[model samples]
Target: MSRFIAFFALVGLIGFALPRSAASQDWQLTDANTFAPANYLILTIPQDEPQALAALADTLAADFGVSLAAEWSLNALEVHCFVFDARNVSDVDGLITAMETDARIRTVQRLRSFSLTEMFHSDPLLPLQWALQSMRVLPIHASSLGEGVRVGIVDSAIDNHHPDLADQMVDLFDFVAADPVPLAEAHGTAVAGIIGAAATNEGIVGVAPSADMVGLRACWQQDGAPGVCNSFSLARAINFAILNDIDVLNLSIGGPEDPLLTELINVALEAGIVVVAASGEGQELVYPASLDGVIAAGQVAGRSVPAPMVDVLTTAPGSAHRYVSGSSIATAHVSGVVALMLSQDPTLTSAAISERLNGSISDVETLPMLNACTAILGPSEACAL
Candidate 1:
């Protein structure tokens, strides 16, 4: 019976989030100048000959007038080459035909733009949506959403026009360009909205609706391909957050562990700032989530076997109210809950807060999930899980 009910509930949630027509929106061409600056041209070459393929790649880069960024050997039969600034293909269709005709080339794919905002709007467990509903039923009410907290989001840039988050954005910094204005990336804006959207009538409110937000653009915006800023950019962002005396630093991005980043995380910890990071997809742990003093979070559905470990919901971008599931989204949940805890006691140190959160988690025997509020507030001695 539980299985039967769970199946239907999953279907119902999907239906609620996405209507038939809404799913068929046409893919639009990416504007290189708007948000992304360069398009990536990915070419797969025959892998049997490394030296020959490298020579071919150099020839192709010179012939196509594009910069060759990285090349990797994928087994003995394939080599992948990444080309940057490839927006101006003389003839895209012709180029594909030529590549298909080339004996050395195996496949060619163009990187396209993906709407991060639209992706979030389709989430089923929107964080802010859950928080508002929970506020009505829970005994604790946040005196004010983010009454005295400052959150720094190191991602893309926030949309200054987002109705719920616009006013709360206090500053912008572009680590890539060393400028005050952020490079336009919808990913950052969506993240910002999740962290601190206002309780305005236009859309769903953030968990910390009144919190001040600092937008730090640490990720690069490529024209046709997804761009990533390196570990240095991330390390710098963490330092900036610490220097500014930010109460919390939210980092939703992740990659392979770097020693430099590990060192910087330690510095942030010593400075008494709460650092929250998304645990990677599935159970795979990622930094800074895996780092000590950082809250690592996972996602859960409303009907999942166990209550979510930091399974706080949030509003999706744009007008549609969808719920998203990700460690990044979970980071927002922890950040909002931390804001509530700080509101109750401003003197709580970062280490103290981390200890309280880890100790307060409600143990679910069914699954590895922890209740966000219970975790933040600590377990009640009289209550049984």
Candidate 2:
């Protein structure tokens, strides 16, 4: 592996080159922020390049006697939408029924919710994360630290003040509400640390420490420590990625099969963004991850340990770090590696990257663990296929 480092070094050193995006992406919720409103449904209308979006907004606002609190556009489908707040659940259902019969309307549905990729808070003292080492991340990092790549983490807000992670946060937003009521910062903080905690010789280094970090907070604490979000919130974050031309979008959260969320992911993929998702434990896959054309990630079933035990160590919230385990953690590993690859070649399409990853690694429990070095050098020369 060190030889691989020498090879990458001669070719420009394996120190990843990604850096956080500009502050222009940094935005907080304002009164105009349309998501997270109560007793509301999203209404869609077909308009190819909506020449008169305000006119349509006025029509909906005037006819329904409601405010046009927020709006979004599905460029892939050539339609725009408005979020409308109804008085009660009955009114929401009745409005949906009435809208379904309207010839001018395209799509309408009640808002949905999604939960954080469940993670556990463990003791600070833990083993080194082998997931990164196993992927030959050192060689890749020596060549690039995922510089110039923009990764949108759609979870709870990250620790904006962590010494190791503060500089990497180029932008942040709360999609669920004006501001997410942080329940446990460790989960999102840990994920951000895994993806790109700055290499400041601090508690722990991140996978792509220099890569640009964009906190797209779509989940908020509802009843437990883990954050939860619905379809509407998820859609808001995905649309942000598409509109802003984000390089990679990380969906560490999962829930049931949602049509709106599915369509939004499709839009992101079509716009040349690489989406990495986490699969739930066990053979059964979860939504978003189960969606085809996505790079689904999970832990490798190690030969020395029982498959039931998860022992991955990564970044946590606050000043102290912790050990957390789940497919969510594993997905972060892949995401970090993707950033490195993108840093080297921004034009590399998602399909080509997926082909190299899926085709290069030899089968390990029918789901091969990725090797970052091999992905860049081509499996035929650097890895076992």
Candidate 3:
């Protein structure tokens, strides 16, 4: 594994005292920017030949009139990644095609973004998260707080110091920058807040409050900045999750399909980790979720899509709470419930988890709404012999 990959592990950490980052989603700054990169592309070569990888990067840089920004090698998987300088909108597609024609290149992908909201919460808030009722998670919490289940979150920065997440976070690693210091936590804070915020009776509770969490940051952050994650960073995070024996992987971001990421998702599934993904708008699903062996979750109150999408309240970066509305939040709900099920039966495989979820689906119309009590309280389930 690369030194970058090696940085991720469960360890005792210091205090988080960074300034808070406020989120504002204006028209131009949609959440989709998190997964997609307009000017960047991720090139994966099958082998880890340093010279060959350097030559490829130089060739792409020279041909595209760009610079070689950085490179990383996944030694375990023998996958090499090269990140080139940004390009104009007119040049991105052509540059990607030019790189794809190389026989040495196994896959070339234009990094795209996925949508996930980060709203500041204030004023009169619901005493309890309204979405929990629809998800059917409240009842199951009586028996399972998702102990012993490790839920892995691959997204933007999370506030490791936030009271809601400080103690619950089992591990933290970054794929974008090797910063020895902790980076700003926004989207990641919100995502983790939903999945496993501590139930301290301070603010809105998380879905699997007691479940252990390992957060792998593939996206960077800035105040009012959209979520940012490229294929290379995301794959690196996924590889880390797989190597660390993560029980359930939560991918709350998705965009255009990339073969390299697809292969990694397949690898995680084959390793018996339950993978959860978010659904984008329209029938054409997003990557990973669109791929086989991933559970696609959409936020809907009923079978039919409502005019204004349902709003969900979850945890935020600071000690405060927030409301996020989208499929990403919905995906977190499913992941939390899945963790609850895993808490009851830690040996459940991806197939067994899916089977239980599928069998417990009370209504096909409400796609993302899950029957948590049934999924977790049912007979212990595992991969068939």
How do the predictions measure up, each by TM-score?
Answer: 0.56, 0.61, 0.61
Candidate 2 runs further than 4 Å off: 1-127, 179-184, 222-224, 299-309, 362-368, 379-385
lDDT of 1 by residue, 1-385 (tens): 1111111111010111112323332212233334232256567654434445557777887776765654444333434443434656677666666667777666776644331111122223333465433322122233346678888888866666656666878987777775465245655665676667765445655667677789877877566244476887887887798899788888877788889988888888888788888776665567667776677765433211122324344433343344455666666666766776777788888777766665554445444444444544444321224
Task: Tell me the tens digit of each residue's lDDT in model 2 across 1-385.
Answer: 1111111212111112211221122111124333453466667786533336567767766766666655655445656666676653456666678778877678887554322221111212212655555565654555678889999998876887776677889988888776455434666787888888776544465668779989998877544467677888889999999999699898888789999889989989999999988876766667788887777777433311111115666666566676788877777777887888899888899888887666545544464566676787664233333
- Arrange candidates by TM-score, highest first: which order? 2, 3, 1
TM-score of 2: 0.61
In candidate 3, what are the lDDT values of residues 205-273, reduced to their tens digit? 678889999989998777768687899999899999889989889987878888888988999999988
Off by over 4 Å in 1: 1-128, 131-139, 142-144, 178-184, 221-227, 299-323, 363-370, 375-385
C-alpha RMSD between model 2 and the true structure: 24.9
lDDT of 2: 0.67
Better of 1 and 3 by TM-score: 3
Model 3: residues with Cα > 4 Å off, grouped in runs: 1-126, 299-309, 363-368, 378-385
The C-alpha RMSD of each candidate to the native structure, in angstroms, is 25.3, 24.9, 25.9
